[model samples]
Target: MGAARAGNGSDGIATNLPEADDYCLTARDIRCVVLDIEGTTTPIPFVTDVLFPYARSNVRAYLVDTYRTRQTMDDVAFLRAQIDKDLADGVPSAVLVPPPSAPEEEVIDALVANVEAMIDADRKLPALKQLQGRIWRLGFDGGEIQGVVYDDVAEALARWHGTGTVRSYIYSSGSREAQRLIFGNTEAHGDLRRYLSAFFDTSVGGKREPRSYYEIWQTLGVDSPSQILFLTDVYQEATAARDAGFEVLISIRPGNAPLPEDHGFQTITSFAQISV
Candidate 1:
Protein backbone atom coordinates (compact mmCIF):
# COMPACT_ATOMS: atom_id res chain seq x y z
CA MET A 1 0.00 0.00 0.00
CA GLY A 2 1.23 3.51 -0.89
CA ALA A 3 1.00 6.66 1.26
CA ALA A 4 -1.35 9.64 0.87
CA ARG A 5 -3.31 12.10 3.02
CA ALA A 6 -6.08 10.90 5.34
CA GLY A 7 -9.68 11.23 4.22
CA ASN A 8 -11.86 14.04 5.69
CA GLY A 9 -15.38 12.69 5.14
CA SER A 10 -15.80 14.35 1.76
CA ASP A 11 -16.65 12.37 -1.37
CA GLY A 12 -12.83 11.93 -1.62
CA ILE A 13 -12.88 11.72 -5.38
CA ALA A 14 -9.66 12.26 -7.24
CA THR A 15 -9.36 15.28 -9.51
CA ASN A 16 -8.72 14.77 -13.26
CA LEU A 17 -9.82 11.15 -13.10
CA PRO A 18 -9.56 9.65 -16.61
CA GLU A 19 -13.32 9.49 -16.91
CA ALA A 20 -15.06 11.31 -14.10
CA ASP A 21 -18.03 8.96 -13.87
CA ASP A 22 -16.56 5.72 -15.23
CA TYR A 23 -15.80 4.07 -11.85
CA CYS A 24 -19.09 2.27 -11.51
CA LEU A 25 -18.68 -1.48 -10.96
CA THR A 26 -22.18 -2.13 -12.27
CA ALA A 27 -21.19 -0.70 -15.62
CA ARG A 28 -18.34 -3.19 -15.90
CA ASP A 29 -20.38 -6.19 -14.76
CA ILE A 30 -18.27 -6.65 -11.67
CA ARG A 31 -19.35 -9.25 -9.10
CA CYS A 32 -16.49 -9.41 -6.63
CA VAL A 33 -14.62 -6.52 -4.98
CA VAL A 34 -11.13 -7.37 -3.77
CA LEU A 35 -9.73 -4.66 -1.47
CA ASP A 36 -6.30 -3.80 -0.16
CA ILE A 37 -6.00 -3.02 3.55
CA GLU A 38 -3.31 -0.48 4.42
CA GLY A 39 -3.48 2.79 2.51
CA THR A 40 -6.68 1.57 0.87
CA THR A 41 -9.44 0.62 3.27
CA THR A 42 -7.35 1.49 6.32
CA PRO A 43 -4.91 4.34 6.89
CA ILE A 44 -1.24 3.55 6.34
CA PRO A 45 -0.23 5.09 9.66
CA PHE A 46 -2.42 2.66 11.58
CA VAL A 47 -0.31 -0.20 10.26
CA THR A 48 3.00 1.65 10.28
CA ASP A 49 2.23 3.23 13.63
CA VAL A 50 0.04 1.01 15.81
CA LEU A 51 0.29 -2.47 14.27
CA PHE A 52 3.97 -2.76 13.27
CA PRO A 53 5.22 -1.28 16.51
CA TYR A 54 2.93 -3.52 18.53
CA ALA A 55 4.31 -6.59 16.80
CA ARG A 56 7.93 -5.45 17.13
CA SER A 57 7.71 -4.54 20.80
CA ASN A 58 5.86 -7.71 21.77
CA VAL A 59 7.56 -10.31 19.56
CA ARG A 60 10.13 -11.39 22.12
CA ALA A 61 7.58 -11.71 24.91
CA TYR A 62 5.18 -13.51 22.61
CA LEU A 63 7.90 -15.98 21.63
CA VAL A 64 9.06 -16.45 25.20
CA ASP A 65 5.55 -16.91 26.54
CA THR A 66 4.51 -19.28 23.81
CA TYR A 67 7.95 -20.85 23.38
CA ARG A 68 7.01 -24.43 24.16
CA THR A 69 3.69 -24.47 22.38
CA ARG A 70 3.24 -26.54 19.20
CA GLN A 71 2.27 -23.43 17.23
CA THR A 72 5.36 -21.47 18.24
CA MET A 73 7.46 -24.53 17.46
CA ASP A 74 5.87 -24.67 14.02
CA ASP A 75 6.42 -20.94 13.52
CA VAL A 76 10.04 -21.38 14.55
CA ALA A 77 10.52 -24.19 12.08
CA PHE A 78 9.07 -22.07 9.29
CA LEU A 79 11.26 -19.09 10.21
CA ARG A 80 14.30 -21.30 10.42
CA ALA A 81 13.73 -22.50 6.87
CA GLN A 82 13.31 -18.94 5.56
CA ILE A 83 16.29 -17.63 7.52
CA ASP A 84 18.39 -20.49 6.22
CA LYS A 85 17.54 -19.50 2.68
CA ASP A 86 18.22 -15.87 3.53
CA LEU A 87 21.55 -16.76 5.08
CA ALA A 88 22.55 -18.76 2.03
CA ASP A 89 21.58 -15.82 -0.17
CA GLY A 90 23.63 -13.55 2.15
CA VAL A 91 20.62 -11.46 2.99
CA PRO A 92 21.71 -8.49 5.07
CA SER A 93 20.90 -8.92 8.76
CA ALA A 94 20.13 -12.61 8.31
CA VAL A 95 20.99 -14.59 11.45
CA LEU A 96 21.34 -18.28 12.13
CA VAL A 97 18.65 -19.89 14.24
CA PRO A 98 20.11 -22.48 16.57
CA PRO A 99 18.95 -26.09 16.43
CA PRO A 100 15.87 -26.97 18.48
CA SER A 101 18.18 -28.73 20.95
CA ALA A 102 19.89 -25.43 21.71
CA PRO A 103 18.95 -23.40 24.80
CA GLU A 104 15.53 -21.81 24.38
CA GLU A 105 16.85 -18.29 25.15
CA GLU A 106 19.53 -18.62 22.47
CA VAL A 107 17.02 -19.79 19.89
CA ILE A 108 14.57 -17.04 20.77
CA ASP A 109 17.33 -14.43 20.53
CA ALA A 110 18.32 -15.54 17.04
CA LEU A 111 14.70 -15.70 15.92
CA VAL A 112 13.97 -12.27 17.33
CA ALA A 113 16.97 -10.80 15.53
CA ASN A 114 15.92 -12.26 12.21
CA VAL A 115 12.27 -11.31 12.70
CA GLU A 116 13.23 -7.72 13.55
CA ALA A 117 15.37 -7.51 10.43
CA MET A 118 12.53 -8.80 8.27
CA ILE A 119 10.09 -6.33 9.83
CA ASP A 120 12.52 -3.45 9.40
CA ALA A 121 12.94 -4.26 5.72
CA ASP A 122 9.16 -4.57 5.33
CA ARG A 123 9.69 -7.96 3.77
CA LYS A 124 6.40 -9.63 2.77
CA LEU A 125 7.55 -13.17 3.53
CA PRO A 126 4.75 -15.36 4.80
CA ALA A 127 6.71 -16.62 7.78
CA LEU A 128 7.25 -13.11 9.15
CA LYS A 129 3.65 -12.08 8.39
CA GLN A 130 2.20 -15.20 10.00
CA LEU A 131 4.19 -14.67 13.19
CA GLN A 132 3.25 -11.00 13.33
CA GLY A 133 -0.41 -11.92 12.97
CA ARG A 134 -0.22 -14.17 16.00
CA ILE A 135 1.43 -11.44 18.01
CA TRP A 136 -1.21 -8.93 16.92
CA ARG A 137 -4.02 -11.30 17.78
CA LEU A 138 -3.00 -10.98 21.41
CA GLY A 139 -3.06 -7.19 21.26
CA PHE A 140 -6.46 -7.09 19.53
CA ASP A 141 -7.99 -9.65 21.86
CA GLY A 142 -6.60 -7.89 24.93
CA GLY A 143 -8.12 -4.52 23.96
CA GLU A 144 -4.66 -3.06 23.57
CA ILE A 145 -5.26 -2.37 19.89
CA GLN A 146 -8.24 -1.51 17.72
CA GLY A 147 -8.27 -1.69 13.92
CA VAL A 148 -8.68 1.56 12.01
CA VAL A 149 -10.40 1.86 8.63
CA TYR A 150 -11.55 4.71 6.41
CA ASP A 151 -14.77 6.34 7.55
CA ASP A 152 -16.69 5.25 4.48
CA VAL A 153 -15.58 1.62 4.48
CA ALA A 154 -18.18 0.11 6.79
CA GLU A 155 -21.17 1.70 5.07
CA ALA A 156 -19.90 0.77 1.64
CA LEU A 157 -19.28 -2.80 2.75
CA ALA A 158 -22.76 -2.93 4.17
CA ARG A 159 -24.25 -1.55 0.95
CA TRP A 160 -22.49 -4.14 -1.16
CA HIS A 161 -23.40 -6.97 1.19
CA GLY A 162 -27.01 -5.85 1.26
CA THR A 163 -27.26 -6.00 -2.51
CA GLY A 164 -26.33 -9.70 -2.49
CA THR A 165 -24.97 -9.11 -5.98
CA VAL A 166 -21.43 -8.17 -4.97
CA ARG A 167 -18.97 -9.99 -2.73
CA SER A 168 -16.16 -8.20 -0.86
CA TYR A 169 -12.77 -9.81 -0.32
CA ILE A 170 -9.46 -8.63 1.07
CA TYR A 171 -6.07 -9.23 -0.57
CA SER A 172 -3.12 -7.99 1.44
CA SER A 173 0.52 -8.78 2.10
CA GLY A 174 -0.55 -9.16 5.75
CA SER A 175 -1.53 -12.69 6.70
CA ARG A 176 -5.17 -13.79 6.50
CA GLU A 177 -5.29 -13.86 10.29
CA ALA A 178 -4.07 -10.27 10.49
CA GLN A 179 -6.64 -9.21 7.92
CA ARG A 180 -9.43 -10.78 9.96
CA LEU A 181 -8.18 -9.20 13.18
CA ILE A 182 -8.34 -5.74 11.63
CA PHE A 183 -11.68 -6.03 9.88
CA GLY A 184 -13.19 -8.03 12.72
CA ASN A 185 -12.24 -5.45 15.34
CA THR A 186 -12.38 -2.10 13.64
CA GLU A 187 -12.93 1.10 15.66
CA ALA A 188 -15.60 2.45 13.34
CA HIS A 189 -17.49 -0.76 12.80
CA GLY A 190 -17.00 -3.64 15.15
CA ASP A 191 -16.94 -7.05 13.48
CA LEU A 192 -16.75 -5.91 9.86
CA ARG A 193 -15.71 -9.47 8.95
CA ARG A 194 -19.37 -10.21 8.39
CA TYR A 195 -19.18 -7.91 5.37
CA LEU A 196 -16.20 -9.66 3.84
CA SER A 197 -16.44 -12.95 1.99
CA ALA A 198 -12.83 -14.19 2.36
CA PHE A 199 -9.27 -13.14 3.13
CA PHE A 200 -6.11 -13.77 1.06
CA ASP A 201 -2.45 -13.36 1.84
CA THR A 202 0.93 -13.87 0.08
CA SER A 203 0.18 -17.61 0.07
CA VAL A 204 -1.52 -17.14 -3.29
CA GLY A 205 1.50 -15.18 -4.61
CA GLY A 206 3.24 -11.81 -4.33
CA LYS A 207 0.90 -8.86 -4.70
CA ARG A 208 2.91 -7.55 -7.66
CA GLU A 209 2.70 -10.81 -9.64
CA PRO A 210 -0.02 -11.10 -12.28
CA ARG A 211 -0.37 -14.80 -11.56
CA SER A 212 -1.49 -13.97 -8.03
CA TYR A 213 -4.48 -12.11 -9.40
CA TYR A 214 -5.11 -15.03 -11.77
CA GLU A 215 -5.12 -17.37 -8.77
CA ILE A 216 -7.53 -15.08 -6.91
CA TRP A 217 -9.84 -15.05 -9.92
CA GLN A 218 -9.85 -18.84 -10.01
CA THR A 219 -10.53 -19.10 -6.29
CA LEU A 220 -13.32 -16.54 -6.47
CA GLY A 221 -15.22 -18.92 -8.78
CA VAL A 222 -16.30 -16.06 -10.96
CA ASP A 223 -17.27 -16.63 -14.57
CA SER A 224 -14.32 -14.54 -15.73
CA PRO A 225 -11.57 -12.38 -14.35
CA SER A 226 -13.45 -9.41 -15.77
CA GLN A 227 -16.10 -10.03 -13.17
CA ILE A 228 -13.65 -9.19 -10.35
CA LEU A 229 -12.72 -5.63 -9.46
CA PHE A 230 -9.51 -5.02 -7.49
CA LEU A 231 -8.73 -1.85 -5.51
CA THR A 232 -5.25 -1.03 -4.33
CA ASP A 233 -2.97 1.92 -3.58
CA VAL A 234 0.09 0.40 -5.24
CA TYR A 235 0.62 1.04 -8.92
CA GLN A 236 2.33 -2.30 -9.51
CA GLU A 237 -0.51 -4.22 -7.85
CA ALA A 238 -3.08 -2.34 -9.92
CA THR A 239 -1.08 -3.15 -13.05
CA ALA A 240 -0.84 -6.78 -12.06
CA ALA A 241 -4.58 -7.12 -11.54
CA ARG A 242 -5.31 -5.33 -14.80
CA ASP A 243 -2.85 -7.56 -16.59
CA ALA A 244 -4.75 -10.55 -15.27
CA GLY A 245 -8.00 -9.17 -16.81
CA PHE A 246 -9.61 -7.83 -13.65
CA GLU A 247 -11.01 -4.32 -13.52
CA VAL A 248 -8.60 -2.22 -11.45
CA LEU A 249 -8.92 0.94 -9.39
CA ILE A 250 -6.13 2.82 -7.66
CA SER A 251 -7.22 3.97 -4.20
CA ILE A 252 -6.16 7.56 -3.43
CA ARG A 253 -6.25 7.48 0.34
CA PRO A 254 -4.34 9.97 2.48
CA GLY A 255 -0.69 9.01 3.08
CA ASN A 256 -0.61 6.75 0.00
CA ALA A 257 2.56 6.83 -2.03
CA PRO A 258 2.35 8.82 -5.21
CA LEU A 259 1.53 6.98 -8.41
CA PRO A 260 3.39 7.41 -11.69
CA GLU A 261 2.07 10.19 -13.90
CA ASP A 262 1.38 7.69 -16.66
CA HIS A 263 -0.16 5.00 -14.47
CA GLY A 264 -3.41 5.43 -16.44
CA PHE A 265 -5.79 3.69 -14.04
CA GLN A 266 -9.00 5.16 -12.70
CA THR A 267 -8.73 6.34 -9.07
CA ILE A 268 -11.15 6.53 -6.14
CA THR A 269 -10.62 8.23 -2.80
CA SER A 270 -13.56 6.69 -1.01
CA PHE A 271 -15.54 3.44 -1.26
CA ALA A 272 -18.62 5.58 -1.88
CA GLN A 273 -17.23 6.38 -5.32
CA ILE A 274 -17.78 2.77 -6.29
CA SER A 275 -21.37 2.22 -7.41
CA VAL A 276 -21.70 -1.51 -6.93
Candidate 2:
Protein backbone atom coordinates (compact mmCIF):
# COMPACT_ATOMS: atom_id res chain seq x y z
CA MET A 1 0.00 0.00 0.00
CA GLY A 2 3.04 2.25 0.26
CA ALA A 3 3.20 2.27 -3.52
CA ALA A 4 1.93 5.51 -5.06
CA ARG A 5 -1.60 5.39 -6.42
CA ALA A 6 -2.71 6.27 -9.94
CA GLY A 7 -3.42 10.01 -10.11
CA ASN A 8 -2.54 13.26 -11.81
CA GLY A 9 0.86 14.60 -10.81
CA SER A 10 1.36 18.05 -9.36
CA ASP A 11 2.36 19.32 -12.79
CA GLY A 12 -1.18 18.66 -14.06
CA ILE A 13 0.25 15.82 -16.20
CA ALA A 14 -0.92 12.26 -15.78
CA THR A 15 1.78 9.59 -15.65
CA ASN A 16 2.19 5.95 -14.73
CA LEU A 17 1.41 5.51 -11.05
CA PRO A 18 4.44 5.64 -8.74
CA GLU A 19 6.89 6.68 -11.46
CA ALA A 20 9.36 8.32 -9.06
CA ASP A 21 11.64 9.72 -11.71
CA ASP A 22 8.76 11.44 -13.43
CA TYR A 23 7.76 13.22 -10.20
CA CYS A 24 11.33 14.18 -9.37
CA LEU A 25 11.49 17.87 -10.15
CA THR A 26 14.70 19.64 -11.15
CA ALA A 27 16.62 19.84 -7.84
CA ARG A 28 18.52 22.97 -8.70
CA ASP A 29 15.58 25.34 -8.33
CA ILE A 30 14.21 24.00 -5.05
CA ARG A 31 15.25 26.03 -2.01
CA CYS A 32 13.49 24.42 0.93
CA VAL A 33 11.78 21.17 1.87
CA VAL A 34 9.04 21.44 4.49
CA LEU A 35 7.85 18.11 5.88
CA ASP A 36 4.87 16.90 7.89
CA ILE A 37 5.55 14.69 10.88
CA GLU A 38 3.09 11.79 11.04
CA GLY A 39 3.14 9.65 7.89
CA THR A 40 5.65 11.79 6.10
CA THR A 41 8.90 11.92 8.06
CA THR A 42 7.72 9.36 10.63
CA PRO A 43 5.31 6.44 10.64
CA ILE A 44 1.72 7.06 11.71
CA PRO A 45 1.64 4.19 14.20
CA PHE A 46 4.63 5.60 16.01
CA VAL A 47 2.56 8.70 16.79
CA THR A 48 -0.99 7.29 17.14
CA ASP A 49 0.08 4.08 18.87
CA VAL A 50 3.14 5.19 20.78
CA LEU A 51 3.69 8.87 21.60
CA PHE A 52 0.07 9.94 21.99
CA PRO A 53 -0.75 7.00 24.21
CA TYR A 54 2.29 7.69 26.33
CA ALA A 55 1.22 11.29 26.78
CA ARG A 56 -2.38 10.42 27.53
CA SER A 57 -1.63 7.72 30.09
CA ASN A 58 0.92 9.85 31.90
CA VAL A 59 -0.82 13.26 31.74
CA ARG A 60 -2.79 13.16 34.99
CA ALA A 61 0.02 11.82 37.12
CA TYR A 62 2.53 14.09 35.46
CA LEU A 63 0.39 17.20 35.93
CA VAL A 64 -0.60 16.48 39.53
CA ASP A 65 2.93 15.55 40.45
CA THR A 66 4.45 18.64 38.90
CA TYR A 67 1.69 21.15 39.61
CA ARG A 68 3.88 23.47 41.64
CA THR A 69 6.75 23.70 39.22
CA ARG A 70 7.09 26.88 37.15
CA GLN A 71 6.86 24.99 33.86
CA THR A 72 3.70 23.25 34.92
CA MET A 73 2.18 26.48 36.16
CA ASP A 74 2.92 28.20 32.85
CA ASP A 75 1.18 25.46 30.92
CA VAL A 76 -1.75 25.55 33.32
CA ALA A 77 -1.99 29.29 32.92
CA PHE A 78 -2.11 28.92 29.16
CA LEU A 79 -4.79 26.29 29.42
CA ARG A 80 -6.77 28.48 31.76
CA ALA A 81 -6.65 31.28 29.21
CA GLN A 82 -7.80 28.89 26.51
CA ILE A 83 -10.65 27.74 28.72
CA ASP A 84 -11.65 31.32 29.32
CA LYS A 85 -11.72 31.88 25.59
CA ASP A 86 -13.83 28.78 25.06
CA LEU A 87 -16.28 29.91 27.71
CA ALA A 88 -16.45 33.39 26.20
CA ASP A 89 -17.15 31.88 22.78
CA GLY A 90 -19.88 29.64 24.27
CA VAL A 91 -17.98 26.44 23.57
CA PRO A 92 -18.86 23.66 25.96
CA SER A 93 -15.76 22.34 27.70
CA ALA A 94 -14.54 21.32 31.10
CA VAL A 95 -13.54 24.28 33.21
CA LEU A 96 -11.65 24.94 36.43
CA VAL A 97 -14.37 25.18 39.05
CA PRO A 98 -14.58 28.14 41.50
CA PRO A 99 -12.51 30.24 39.15
CA PRO A 100 -9.74 32.46 40.65
CA SER A 101 -10.35 31.19 44.18
CA ALA A 102 -10.12 27.43 44.03
CA PRO A 103 -7.40 25.68 46.00
CA GLU A 104 -4.27 25.16 43.93
CA GLU A 105 -4.53 21.38 44.03
CA GLU A 106 -8.21 21.43 43.13
CA VAL A 107 -7.59 23.72 40.16
CA ILE A 108 -4.70 21.53 39.05
CA ASP A 109 -6.93 18.48 39.30
CA ALA A 110 -9.63 20.03 37.15
CA LEU A 111 -7.06 21.22 34.59
CA VAL A 112 -5.48 17.78 34.48
CA ALA A 113 -8.84 16.18 33.83
CA ASN A 114 -9.58 18.66 31.04
CA VAL A 115 -6.17 18.17 29.50
CA GLU A 116 -6.51 14.41 29.60
CA ALA A 117 -9.92 14.68 27.97
CA MET A 118 -8.38 16.82 25.22
CA ILE A 119 -5.68 14.22 24.69
CA ASP A 120 -8.22 11.41 24.48
CA ALA A 121 -10.28 13.42 22.02
CA ASP A 122 -7.12 14.07 19.97
CA ARG A 123 -7.77 17.78 19.89
CA LYS A 124 -4.80 19.79 18.58
CA LEU A 125 -5.01 22.48 21.22
CA PRO A 126 -1.81 24.45 21.81
CA ALA A 127 -1.93 24.06 25.57
CA LEU A 128 -2.30 20.29 25.20
CA LYS A 129 0.65 20.20 22.82
CA GLN A 130 2.73 22.19 25.30
CA LEU A 131 1.88 19.89 28.18
CA GLN A 132 2.60 16.82 26.07
CA GLY A 133 5.88 18.26 24.86
CA ARG A 134 7.01 18.80 28.43
CA ILE A 135 6.01 15.28 29.42
CA TRP A 136 7.71 13.85 26.33
CA ARG A 137 10.88 15.74 27.22
CA LEU A 138 11.06 13.76 30.44
CA GLY A 139 10.40 10.50 28.57
CA PHE A 140 13.01 11.26 25.96
CA ASP A 141 15.54 12.32 28.58
CA GLY A 142 14.98 9.10 30.53
CA GLY A 143 15.30 6.96 27.39
CA GLU A 144 11.69 5.85 27.73
CA ILE A 145 10.69 7.46 24.45
CA GLN A 146 12.91 6.96 21.47
CA GLY A 147 11.45 8.69 18.46
CA VAL A 148 10.70 6.63 15.36
CA VAL A 149 11.64 8.55 12.25
CA TYR A 150 11.59 6.57 8.99
CA ASP A 151 14.91 5.21 7.65
CA ASP A 152 14.79 7.24 4.43
CA VAL A 153 14.03 10.51 6.25
CA ALA A 154 17.50 11.05 7.66
CA GLU A 155 19.17 10.43 4.31
CA ALA A 156 16.80 12.71 2.47
CA LEU A 157 17.27 15.46 5.07
CA ALA A 158 21.03 15.17 4.72
CA ARG A 159 20.88 15.35 0.94
CA TRP A 160 18.63 18.41 0.97
CA HIS A 161 20.61 20.25 3.64
CA GLY A 162 24.00 19.20 2.24
CA THR A 163 23.57 21.78 -0.45
CA GLY A 164 23.72 25.32 0.87
CA THR A 165 21.00 26.06 -1.65
CA VAL A 166 18.30 23.82 -0.18
CA ARG A 167 17.14 23.79 3.46
CA SER A 168 14.96 21.36 5.41
CA TYR A 169 12.11 22.19 7.82
CA ILE A 170 9.32 20.52 9.76
CA TYR A 171 5.73 21.79 9.91
CA SER A 172 3.45 19.70 12.06
CA SER A 173 0.61 20.22 14.51
CA GLY A 174 3.10 19.18 17.17
CA SER A 175 4.57 22.05 19.08
CA ARG A 176 8.06 23.23 18.11
CA GLU A 177 9.43 21.76 21.31
CA ALA A 178 7.74 18.45 20.58
CA GLN A 179 9.18 18.46 17.09
CA ARG A 180 12.62 19.15 18.54
CA LEU A 181 12.26 16.38 21.10
CA ILE A 182 11.43 13.77 18.46
CA PHE A 183 14.15 14.72 15.98
CA GLY A 184 16.60 15.26 18.81
CA ASN A 185 16.00 11.79 20.23
CA THR A 186 15.39 9.60 17.20
CA GLU A 187 16.47 5.96 17.32
CA ALA A 188 18.04 6.22 13.87
CA HIS A 189 20.56 8.96 13.04
CA GLY A 190 20.71 9.79 16.81
CA ASP A 191 19.60 13.41 16.90
CA LEU A 192 18.83 14.34 13.33
CA ARG A 193 17.90 17.81 14.62
CA ARG A 194 21.17 19.09 13.17
CA TYR A 195 19.81 18.47 9.69
CA LEU A 196 16.67 20.52 10.28
CA SER A 197 16.90 24.27 9.84
CA ALA A 198 13.63 25.23 11.54
CA PHE A 199 10.30 23.97 12.84
CA PHE A 200 6.71 25.24 12.48
CA ASP A 201 3.57 24.16 14.26
CA THR A 202 -0.19 24.88 14.23
CA SER A 203 0.78 28.13 15.92
CA VAL A 204 1.67 29.27 12.43
CA GLY A 205 -1.88 28.38 11.33
CA GLY A 206 -4.09 25.42 10.55
CA LYS A 207 -2.43 22.85 8.27
CA ARG A 208 -5.53 22.73 6.04
CA GLU A 209 -5.48 26.48 5.47
CA PRO A 210 -3.51 27.95 2.56
CA ARG A 211 -2.50 30.95 4.69
CA SER A 212 -0.49 28.67 6.96
CA TYR A 213 1.65 27.62 4.01
CA TYR A 214 2.10 31.26 3.09
CA GLU A 215 3.23 32.06 6.65
CA ILE A 216 5.71 29.18 6.49
CA TRP A 217 7.07 30.40 3.17
CA GLN A 218 7.45 33.92 4.54
CA THR A 219 9.11 32.63 7.70
CA LEU A 220 11.63 30.66 5.65
CA GLY A 221 12.89 33.90 4.10
CA VAL A 222 12.00 32.70 0.61
CA ASP A 223 10.38 34.99 -1.94
CA SER A 224 8.83 32.37 -4.16
CA PRO A 225 6.64 29.69 -2.57
CA SER A 226 7.50 27.53 -5.61
CA GLN A 227 11.00 27.14 -4.19
CA ILE A 228 9.62 25.10 -1.32
CA LEU A 229 8.36 21.54 -1.65
CA PHE A 230 5.77 20.63 0.99
CA LEU A 231 5.45 16.91 1.64
CA THR A 232 2.50 15.47 3.57
CA ASP A 233 0.33 12.34 3.53
CA VAL A 234 -3.01 14.15 3.92
CA TYR A 235 -4.77 15.34 0.75
CA GLN A 236 -6.13 18.46 2.46
CA GLU A 237 -2.61 19.48 3.41
CA ALA A 238 -1.36 18.85 -0.11
CA THR A 239 -4.20 20.95 -1.49
CA ALA A 240 -3.49 23.76 0.97
CA ALA A 241 0.17 23.82 0.03
CA ARG A 242 -0.63 23.77 -3.66
CA ASP A 243 -3.06 26.64 -3.19
CA ALA A 244 -0.32 28.56 -1.42
CA GLY A 245 1.88 28.03 -4.48
CA PHE A 246 4.30 25.60 -2.90
CA GLU A 247 5.17 22.41 -4.77
CA VAL A 248 3.32 19.55 -3.05
CA LEU A 249 3.69 15.77 -2.82
CA ILE A 250 1.56 13.18 -1.09
CA SER A 251 3.83 10.88 0.91
CA ILE A 252 2.88 7.21 0.54
CA ARG A 253 4.51 5.47 3.47
CA PRO A 254 3.87 2.22 5.25
CA GLY A 255 1.03 2.61 7.81
CA ASN A 256 -0.28 5.78 6.17
CA ALA A 257 -3.92 6.03 5.16
CA PRO A 258 -4.68 5.15 1.56
CA LEU A 259 -4.92 8.14 -0.76
CA PRO A 260 -7.80 8.60 -3.17
CA GLU A 261 -7.02 7.43 -6.72
CA ASP A 262 -8.33 10.68 -8.10
CA HIS A 263 -6.20 12.84 -5.81
CA GLY A 264 -4.33 15.09 -8.22
CA PHE A 265 -1.18 15.68 -6.17
CA GLN A 266 1.90 13.71 -7.13
CA THR A 267 2.82 10.88 -4.78
CA ILE A 268 6.14 9.38 -3.68
CA THR A 269 6.72 6.14 -1.73
CA SER A 270 10.02 7.17 -0.20
CA PHE A 271 11.90 10.36 0.47
CA ALA A 272 14.66 8.94 -1.71
CA GLN A 273 12.15 9.06 -4.56
CA ILE A 274 12.16 12.84 -4.20
CA SER A 275 15.19 14.60 -5.78
CA VAL A 276 15.26 17.80 -3.74
Clash tally, candidates in order = 11, 0
Report the C-alpha lDDT of model 2 over 1-276, residue by residue, as the tens digit.
134445555544443454444345465377888999998999888888888889888887887788788988788788988777766877565665446477867786777667777777778888889888988888999999998888888998888777667789999999999999999999977989889999999999999999999999989988799989999999889999999999988887766666656567667778888774
Q: Please provide the root mean square deviation of candidate 1 (C-alpha atoms, Å).
A: 4.1
Q: After superposition, how far is residue 18 of candidate 1 from its true place, in Å?
A: 3.4
> For candidate 2, which ten residues in a row score worst on lDDT?
13-22
TM-scores of the candidates in the order shown = 0.93, 0.88
Instruction: Compose the digit string of candidate 1's lDDT tens values, residues 142-223.
Output: 9999999887888999999999999999999999999999999998789999999999999999999999999999999999
Q: lDDT per model, in order?
A: 0.89, 0.82
Q: Which stretches in model 1 have alpha-carbon errors above 4 Å?
A: 1-22
Question: Over the full model, what C-alpha lDDT does candidate 1 score relative to the true structure?
Answer: 0.89
